[model samples]
Target: MRRILIVGAGQAGLQLALGLQAQDYDVTVMSNRTADEIRGGRVMSTQCMFDQALQHERDTQINFWESQAPRVQGLGVSVAAPDGSRAIDWLGHLDHYAQSVDQRLKMAGWLETFAQRGGQLVVHGAAVSDLDFFARTYDLVLVAAGKGELVSMFARDAERSPYDAPQRALAVAYVHGLGPRPEHPDTEAVRCNLVPGVGELFVIPCLTTSGRCDTLFWEGVPGGPLDVFRDIKDPAEHLATTLELMEKFLPWEYARATKVELTDAGGTLAGRYAPTVRKPVGRLPGGGAVLGVADVVVANDPITGQGSNSASKCAAAYLAAILEHGDRPFDEAWMQATFDRYWETARHVTTWTNAMLAPPPEHVVNMLGAAGELQPVADRFANGFNNPADFEEWFYDPAKTEAYLASVTG
Candidate 1:
């Protein structure tokens, strides 16, 4: 039996462990902290798993996704322009889709599944100084240390652009007491607004510990109206600043949900909200190979909510590669095939969404006004996000995007 050691028991690591164990590989997962520690601690991040990814979970493991559907079935999204003007209802594009549970719960559930299947979990305290020991011990070692820690591993090979500039830091709050669906609720779905020279504000529904739905949200683009709240030490002020910013940038929805309360709501979610962090796919100088996934490699402005979905898709592909090449060294060919497959798969959608959030191109603005024609294009684009293989087959193929563009435009 092949022995494998996976570092970082977060989403990708846990998912890989479960898949490999089912294939009957000798698998052990090591994380810097215990499962309870990771679950109870850590600043909460939002994760949205699409229908396809959920189905992947179901197809792979019988009970995997079945446990989380209450939170996954109905997903809603919308776009708000600077003046609080509405674009096409983003929910329409997502009505056919399903979402996943919070990141922490999702990871915990999967980790438990891995353990039940005869996999081992070791909580290795912060930092593993050497991989040579592990390389000798296990048939393969997978690293998925998220955001900040993963950056250094890819510093040398990445090309940086101004778009990489962290235009704004994000302040997210996971709040409760937001009452379960008011009779005439503001918007029936998640809300996103673009405040011209200011920043973007996004509020989406999430599940609370009470099992009632509340919102896991963020106020974006750090330099504008809420800049004063940037460095505050007070939790109340942090929540206050988010409220103030929401009122200014997203008045309609804010007005509708004024009475909703906030929990652990406040200050910058990350001290520095925005910084350009993109790295090339390759190995670390210390010898073990590492490929950046999700926010680590493709940290884009969260204005699109594509971060988690994108990460999950990349992870699924990565998992598939490991299962197929059993006992084979994860060599340069496998690495390139896997990493480049992710890049080729995700690059277009990532780029297109980034462009939408950036200073809008005139053509895009014009295209939005005639949304009747653009709606189907928007739906397909949103659906395509779930699986990149489908995307390449439909949009990125030599002449497909042009045809797709024409069909939407006409």
Candidate 2:
């Protein structure tokens, strides 16, 4: 059995470790935190997994929270006017529901499951110096840690990475007492409110360690009025600031969240990072190289909620490539080829996310306007969040969007 070592027990690392172990390959996973620590730690992200990504988990038998988590059946978008009034309001239905299980719950549960499956689980803070030693022992080493000094091991691919600075100053608070949407109380959906030149706010239903709750996420344009959470350390303060911001930019959502309070002391997180794509191969001290996976290689801004979904897809894609390689050596060529396969899917996500970070192009604005009047257009746009590849057909190009709109309207 060829030994494989995966560093970082995140969505990508754990998924790959488990998949390889299931195939009877020798696998070991290293994580900075233990399951207990993760369960008791601060919330990591607002990860909403769409239909196809959820199916990937089910196929791998890792869909532990599917039965308990809230189901997001569609998408609700409201673009706020300069005066804070709703300019365009629409709800797009999705054919299949998406789900968000807090990373604390999901990652902790997955760590336990990986160990139970006979895969080695090592809990420790791994750095570049550590990778030098690990590279000598394992047949292949994959670094999947999304952040920190470890990620610096891989050089940034300047041509592929579009941004040098952070796109949004992000703040997230998970809270209780968030009332349902008035129009669709029974159907849970990911609600997004866009305040052009200010920021975007997302209200996502999710299952946290404290049970079901809603996550209030802010993606503020840097130095803008919405960028107001730099000094907030208390969860209560975070919740309060969130409500205050909502009241200013998304009053409808603020009204719905009037009774909201933090779910727990650790339910809030605030930070920022540049959306980057790094070379998939990381060179060790002497001469050895390790492969990068998921966020470690392609970290995108959370504007589109594609991080976890992309991680899930990357895990499945890498698993297939590994299995197909059979007894072949895991060489530099193989590593590049594996990442190239995953990049085909990731490029779509990166492109879509980057498009969303900027001001809406005229065609996109037209599309949103049409969506308010056309149910099919709304539904297709809503479903596009699940399978972003569908976007390439009509989203990126103004001419294609115009042609599609004409065909549908006629």
Best by lDDT: 2
Error of 2 at 399 (Å): 1.2
> What lDDT does the true structure give each of the candidates?
0.58, 0.92
Worst 10 residues of 2 by lDDT: 226-235
Pairs with steric clashes in candidate 2: none
What does candidate 1's lDDT look like per residue over 93-121, in tens digits? 55345553556556766776777777898
**Candidate 2: tens digits of C-alpha lDDT, residues 88-129:** 999999999999999999999999999998889988989899
TM-scores vs. true structure, each candidate: 0.81, 0.99
TM-score of model 2 relative to the true fold? Answer: 0.99
Query: Whole-model lDDT, candidate 1?
Result: 0.58
Clashes of each: 6, 0
Instruction: State the TM-score for model 1.
Output: 0.81
Measured with C-alpha atoms, the lDDT of residue 372 in candidate 2 is: 93
